[model samples]
Target: MADTEEMFLRAKHRTFSGLTEGSCPSTRSCGATAERLAERLAERLTEWLTEWLAEQQAERLTERLGERQAEQLTEWLAERLAEWLAERLAEWLTERLAERLAEWLTERLAEPLRDPEEAERQWTGPFCFIQAADPQLGLMKAWRIGDAVGGGDEWEEEVALTKQAVAGVNQLRPRPRFMVLCGDLVHAMPGTEFREAQERDLKEALSGTDPSIPLVFVSGNHDLDQVPTPSTVEQYCRAWGDDYFSFWVGGVLCLVLNSQLYFNGSACPQQKEAQEAWLEAQLSRASSAEPKPKHILVFQHIPLYVKSPDEQDEYFNLPQEARQSLMERFKRAGVTAVFSGHYHRNAGGCQDGLDMVVTSAIGCQLGDDTHGVRLVAVTADAVVHRYFSLEQLGQRGVNEELRKMLQAC
Candidate 1:
């Protein structure tokens, strides 16, 4: 019993000893040692926690201040730059206005609009209007070729030919008061690389020509981009100015239509109807007026007929009904002629007393040939057309291929 009691005490002491060590008894050295150790741990924890919290707070404050400073700096910089730009713009505008005003004042005092010339210049009796078309200015190979003879292309050769044409037109003694271009003023779109080339060529071609000569343009399908967009048309129209408008030169009432209408699908039928109505109105007015227009001349890009071997392949040839309606209307109005292009070859067919004159393409020809335009001499007495090949006008030879094409034609 004594041994058992002693063993039980020993077991109790072993468990209780571990508990006492964990809690630290008050009278033991272990309790004092534990208290010192706890005090040191508390000091170290407090020091570490205090330092960490201070650093976290400082970093947050610094970041907040930096963001605020950045925003303020950006605002200040924007305001300053805006103010500077505004002031500079205002000053520049003011300077320009003042300069323009000075020029206006000078012009008012010095050079007023000139009065009309009453002096009779020798009246070289009124000449007929020339129906010119498709001066495809930017065509890389605007030349002609022969049918039988295989020859080289002469794109560069025709540049001089074009200049010669312009010079010939200018030197016509008494130039045609008005000229018509059936279209394709530029090779491609109005504002494309082709257009830039065209602008340069035109500038050179018309350099020494008379400014009084009036030019009329009929918008060809190629005049704008292949896509039918208003902006492209507007650009061409604006670039050409009043030249793109319709007006009478003498007794001939002329109308130039935008031929791209044919490519506009169902929209085109409506547009065609509207144009026909407009034409009827114009013809009616011209017919009824005193000193009525002796002739009604219509210029457009695509010809109504090509009389090709494969008639179905003709590009944008006028529909039978539309052509018939136009012819009938013009016949009734006593219209004399219609000038057009887009066949790339000359074709003429007269029906119901009106003459249809289709001009040759000024661009490259499909058949080996020389490309050229027509010179029409119309008077009260008669309308005579003479096809003027550039070679004859310039007294020079065209590309052998183009020459062959011309002969084939």
Candidate 2:
């Protein structure tokens, strides 16, 4: 165990130093490094596991198995060890790189206004809103990854976390004027029993929140089919009401878009055209409205980009062509900020004067991040935001319950 730990630490240091010396410029480069590191770690783990197995067999199991059988068993165990180590190392590296990318963006986006007038011009309303995304209620059960660890029923953890989040929102001293769930409310495919259960769990959780606080929903790839169809769209709408719509919350023009259309290969032409026309009209209206909205905030499921607006397309972000076009529109319309939540982690970056905030999930955590929601305060001169993890909000009990459940499983 000590040898394996030393090997991993050395490998991690070498990888990080190599990337730093090479001046790897983007998160994508870090991703490449992570891949290399995973491979290296897997090899080291395989070697360590093989040695340990051989030692055990020689010490006690020699009489139970023949030489050939022991060798085969050792080989099999080494193979599984390599695979598991690779996966775990990749996950760890991805989380580390994500944190670094977020830090880099914070430094890049920190602008100090020299002129008082310039600072005053960005003043927003006094109210605030909460942005939560990807509750993904039944995802744990559907994925079945937890089943192997005796945690097949781990979906309850998601429900508990969500419920805690809703309760936390209600308990805020100055309650948020509204809360926007930026899509993937449920994880099961459309029409699945798991999907229906997810919907029920989510609705029940939200119903416990303060009734005065409005809730807005957006469509995500998970909520609908992987590639949304007309029927899937209809089903989502029937359950959550208009997938795309606009509303006002304390002088803010909040436009909720159906991001599924942006990538849905199965979507009809009319669906695309209608959303485009509607978006243009809404932006135009906001641009010309009397006492023009203090800020234009866009909410969607997927972000335009993760680290930089020019970054290549990834599963976490919008497609390149659509991303560029929509960013142009957002720039033209003076959209202050855009919040999205499909990545299941918190990352933000500013491009062309618009801030893209991709919030962490409120249900299950994908990366090394904790389950939480972003509380954004739109003040007189700036938009301030912070993520509140469940533990920070007096919801550590949920974590305790989850630990017990997983232990029992």
Candidate 3:
């Protein structure tokens, strides 16, 4: 009979070696390894228990046990062995499966960047791009805001404003190389009719843009539900390829993030873990490239910090722990700036030699600011940006009263 230590070593060896093959065998048979292991374990446990029982009986009872007593002992030992084997096998399988899963995830997460050359080509020359956020196409409709003073549909006003923003991008002297809607392209709870309608309206508005200009969408909390989940993210991804990803424009690397993953009280642990892993890999690759990108700019829905990096937690910003850790990572990777939208107002500040620019919304007037989009021009040495109001883009439906009320807030 094998000793306990030897049996354990054999089990460990079989478990480790069989992991890659997706099967384990007990003894010389090729049938279901798990079942075989269970059977073998039960047999071994019964043998061990019988031997121990016999030794105890020899010491306590000088006379040999009767046939009935021996039969009862065998039955009890078999029952105990079955229960013990069942629990042990279950625990072993769970541990092994979890280990394999973790290993596979690590390998996948470490995969090299896809199409590095393509990313380089997209950003090979100095160019400009447009960033528009929080169009919230059905926001007014959801809020029950009435039609405009000019008697237009409440929802159409949002769609028209987005169209105006797109027109603004097309009119740029050298049309922007691309346009990115940072987040909140539509405003409605997920899995709703209004959400679908808002999305269609947004697509129509974007269709008016020059075909040559590329469009990218970032997922915002509003676009997903208030708290993003796998299903909500899938809905966003059906419209946009990925909620978070990186692209290049000349020497600049633009990273768009799903900030909802880091939003306080938003329980998206799997996404948060995966994004963190993917982001680390991307940053590491960029940092080690033969000729690193000259600048790294990030876009997302929520600001990492509002007034300062050390600012206390707020609904409008990322929680403090995540904020500080992300800032450190960005600083280490030499990120030049981060552009975000959620506060619905323009704000700018610099910390740790990095700039944080939060743009105003394109759908509604939240603060004293007008509804607008920011145009960013990337040069060899500097990045220049300016805000353009919808009115500046030939949309004369500016809501002066809303602006006044916002300012009084």
lDDT of 1 at 385: 68
Which candidate model has the greater TM-score, 1 or 3? 3
Worst 10 residues of 2 by lDDT: 11-20
Q: In model 3, what lDDT does residue 281 have?
A: 91
How many Å off is the CA of 95 in candidate 2?
73
CA lDDT of each prediction against the hidden true structure: 0.54, 0.70, 0.68
Q: Encode model 1's per-residue lDDT on 1-409: one tens digit a residue.
A: 3433332222221121221122222233433444455455444544554455445555565577776665565556545544554455445544555455445544553231121111111122335445667666545443333421123223343355556666656655345555566876645455554466665555455444444444455677667654456566657655554212345444455667665654442434554466656666888986786666656677877776666312453455765655666667778888787788876677767776688877876555544445666766656544566666665544433223223332331
TM-score of each: 0.57, 0.64, 0.64
Candidate 3, residues 1-409, lDDT tens digits: the string is 1332232222221221211121222222322343445455555655676566656654444345666676676667656655675567555754564455444543443222233333353335556777878888766564555532222234787887888787766766555766777888877667865677767667777777765566767778888777888898887876655777776655567788999888843567788888999899988887986567877889899999878888889888899998988999999998888899888888868987788888898987668999898877676666666677877744432223222222331
Model 1 alpha-carbon miss at residue 61, Å: 99
- Indicate the TM-score of model 3: 0.64
CA lDDT of 257 in candidate 1?
66
In model 1, which range of ten residues has the least summed lDDT? 113-122
